[model samples]
Target: MPRSWVDGLEARARASLPAPVHEYVAHGAGAGTSRDEAAAAWRDVRFLPHVLHDVTDVGLATEVLGTRLETPVGVAPTSLQRAVHPDGELAMARATAAAGGLMVVSSNAGSTFADIAATGVAWWLQVYLPSDRTLALPLLERAVAAGARAVVLTVDTPVVGSWEPAGDRVWDVVDPAFTRVNFDEGHDTQPGAEKALDLGPHDLDWLAERTGLPVVAKGVLRADDARRCVQAGAAAVWVSNHGGRQLDRAVAPARALPAIVRELADDDAEVYVDGGLGSGTDVLAALGLGADAAFLGRLPLWALVEGEHGVGRLQDRIRAELVEAMRLAGCRRVADARDVVGSPAPV
Candidate 1:
C-alpha cells in the first residue's frame, strides 16, 4: 500500500524541524492540560458504526461567516508558518483554496495577511488585541484591505504563556526568523498591557461598528462568554484553548462546547472549536457536540513543515478520513454530524 500522505508528511516534518520546534510540536502542552486530556479521552470513545445508508453524494460543503466552504474543516491561526516551510502561509492558503477550505491567518504569522490572502482562498484574520486601539485598528484595516473575509478576535491570551524548553535536554535551536511585514512592531505594546486589552462585548461592538467584515470572538470557553460574544454583535463564537499553548489548566474546547452552544442556542451566531483535533472523527465529534465547524492547528503546521506537496496531501487525507468516518457513522453530509454527537461529558 502507498504510504498515507499524513504518515509521510509527519515523517518529513519530524526530519526537517530544528530540535526545539520539533519538541514543541511533539509534546508542547498546547492550550492546556484539559485539552490534552480531552484529545486523549476522545481516542478512547470508539465510534458505534451503523450500516446500509445511501452514502452517495456525501456533501462536505458548509458556510462559515457567510463564506461558502467546500468542507467544514479549516486551518486555525497558528504562528510562525515559515518555521515549518519557506513558502509558509502562501502554500497553506493555496492548498486550502484548492480544496475549497478556509484558512485563518495568525496575527503573529511569519507571513503577512496580504501574502496569505493572495491565494484567493477564503481567509479570516486572527488578532491578539493590543492594549491600545491605535495598534489594533490598523491591523484590522490591513486584514480588510488584504481581502480577509472575517475577523477572529482572540480574547483569551492575556499574556504570553510560559514556554519551558521541552524536556530536560537542551540543544541549540535558534528561533526561526521572519517578519510581520504588514504590522508595526515598534508600536506593539508590552505583553502585560496587551493582555489587559478590553476584549468584552464593548470591544466587539466597537470593532463591528467600524468594519463591514464579520467579527468572530475566538477563545470562548464558557456559555456566558458565548452569549456575550453574540450579544456584542459577533457573527460567530470560536471555542479554543490557543492549542493549549496559553493556559495550563484551561478547559478543553470539546468539554466546553455543549454548554456554550446551549447558552447561545437562541443567538444567530455560529459556534466553532479548535484544540487537539487530529482526524475526521474528531471533526465529526465536534459537530456532534454542537460546533458548526472545527479548526485544525498543529496538523497543518506539520503539513507545512513537510513542504509544498504536503499541503494538498494533508488536506485530501483529512477529507477522505472524514468521508469514511461519515459513511461508517451513517451520515451523508456535514450537517448530519449533529445527529451523532452524544451528550457532553462532565468537566
Candidate 2:
C-alpha cells in the first residue's frame, strides 16, 4: 500500500527543513512524546464505536465567522512561508480554497495580503497587534479592502519569546531578505505599549468600532479571557499556544477547549483550536472536545515545502482521514462529531 499523504508530507518536511526548524517540527509532531510514544498514547484512547445508525451521507461542511467552508479543516496562520516554498502563501491560499478549506493568512506572511486575497477564497487576516495603531490601521484597511471576511487578533507573543527555534533560524537564514512590511521601526515602544501588547477587550472594541469587520481573539487560553473576548465584540475565540512555540509547558489547546467553549457558549462566539493536530481523528477529538473547527499549522507548510502538487494531496489525505474517523465514531457530519466525546477533565 502507498504511504498516506500526511506521512509522505511529514517525511518531506523532515527532509527539507533546516536543522533547527526540523527540530521544532519534530517536537510538535511528537507532542512531547516520542513518535512511537505519541502513537501509543493515541492508541490508549479508542473511540467508543457505535453501529446500527444510518450514516450514508456524511457531511463535512461547516462555517467560521459566517463564511461557509466545505470542510471543517482550515489552514492556520504561519509566518515566513517562502522558507517552505517559492509559491509561498499564494500557493497555500489557492490550494486550500481549491480543496474547500479556509485559509488564515498571517500578518507576518512573506507574501502580501493583497496577493493572497486575489485568490477569492474565504480567508481571514491574522494580525499581531503593534504598539502603535498607526502601523496597524493601514494593514487593517488593506485587509478589509482586499476582501478579508474577518480579522483574528493574535494576543500571544507580547514580546517574542526566547524559545522560538523557528524565529531564530529565520533570523539567521531568511530575515535579511524579508523584513516585516507591516511594522515601522520603533513601533514596539510607542505609548500604551509599556505593558505587554495584548489586544484587550478595549482594544477589540476599538478595532471593531473602527473596522466593522468580524473580530476574533486568537490565543485565548483562559475562560475569563474567553468571556472578555465576547464582551469586547469578538465573533470567535481561537484557543492556541502558537503551536507550543511560545510557552514550553503550556497545556495543549485541545485540553483547554471545553472550558473555553463553556465560558463563551452563551455568547454565541465560535471556538476554534490548533495544536498537536495531525490526523482526522485528532480533528474529530477537537470537535468532540468543543471546538467549532480545527486550524492546521505546519502540516500545510510541510505540503508547501513538498511543492504545489503536495497541497491538494495533503488536504485530500487529511479530509479522508477525518471522514473515516467520523464514520467509525458513528458520526455522519462535522456537527455530529461535536457530541462524540464527553466533557474533558482539567489538564
Candidate 3:
C-alpha cells in the first residue's frame, strides 16, 4: 500500500532531523503507552454514513471562538519548533494563513508574538502560567497587544512529565533563540519562574479578565473539569492529554471526548479535541462525536521539515482528504458531521 500522509511526513522528518531532536519530538511520558495508543484510538472510530445524500459539494468551512476558518482543522501548539526547521513558527504562520487555518502558538515559541502575528495567520496564544504568576503578565500583555485572538490556558501540567531516559534531549543544546524567545529575560531559570504547581480554575478567570480575550481550557480529560473550566469563563474546552507527553496511560482524546461533549451538550461553549488525529476521516469522527473542530499536532510538525512549502502541502492534502471523507459520509457542511459516530463492525 502507498504510504499514508502521516507516515510519509514522519519518515521525511526523521531523515532530516538529528536523532536526539526526533526523539524529543516523538517521545511521550514514561513508557509511551498514552502516546502510542492515541492515533490508534482515532483510527478505530466507525463512521455511520448517511447514504443517498448530495455530496457533490462537501465543504469544510467552520468557525472557532468567533473566527472563520476555511477548514475546521487547525494547527495545535508545539514547542521547540526551531529545532525542526530554521524558519520555525514563522513558516507555520504563513502557511496556515494561506490555507485559512488557525494556529495556536506555544508559550515556548521560538519567535516573538509580533512576528507571528505579522504572518497574518489567525492565531491564539497558548500559556503556561509561571510560579510567579505576575511574571506572565508582561508576556500575556504583549501577546494580546500583538493580536492574539484568544488564550489557550493549559491546565494539566503542574510539572513537566517524566520521559524514560532517551539520551540527551534537544533542549539542552539548541540555541536559546531556538527555544523560548518571547521572554524579556532568561526567566526559565529565575527563582519562582517555574511552572506553577498551584494552578486552579480561578486562573482561567484571571487570564480572560487580564487579556480581555476569551480563554480555552486545554488538556482537560474529564467532564467535571471541563465544566469547571467553562464556568470559570472559558470560551472553549480543548480535550487533550498533551499529545501523551503528559501523564502516561492518560485517556486518549478520542476516548475522552464523548463524556465531555455529553456533559456540555446544552451549554453554549465550543468543544475541541487534539491527539493523534491524523486523517480527514479522523477529523470527521471528532466532529461526529460532537467536537466543533479538530486540531493537528505532530503531523504538521513533521511537515515543517520543508518549512512553509511542506506545511502548505500537508494542509492541502488534509483538506482534500477531509472533503473526500465528508463526501463519502454525506456531510455537505461541518455541522452535519454530528451524531455519525458508531461502533465498528466486527471482522
Ranking by TM-score: 3, 1, 2
Candidate 1 clashing pairs, residues 3+ apart or interchain: 30-243, 30-244, 30-245, 31-243, 31-244, 31-245, 32-244
- Expressed as tens digits, the lDDT of each residue in 77-125 for candidate 1 is 8766776678888889899999999999887777777778777889988
**Judged by lDDT against the true structure, how good is candidate 3?**
0.89
Model 1, residue 220: what's the lDDT? 88
Q: Between which residue pairs do clashes occur in model 2? A: none
Q: Who is ahead in lDDT, 1 or 3?
A: 3
Error of 3 at 323 (Å): 0.4
CA displacement after TM-score superposition, residue 44 of candidate 3 (Å): 1.5
TM-score (all chains, Cα) for each model = 0.89, 0.87, 0.96
Indicate whether candidate 2 or candidate 3 has the larger lDDT.
3
CA RMSD per model (angstroms)? 3.1, 3.5, 2.1
Query: Candidate 2 at residue 18, lDDT?
Result: 73
Tens digit of lDDT per residue, candidate 3, span 158-265? Answer: 988988664356756677678678887867777889899999989999998999999999999999999999898999999999989989999889888988998999
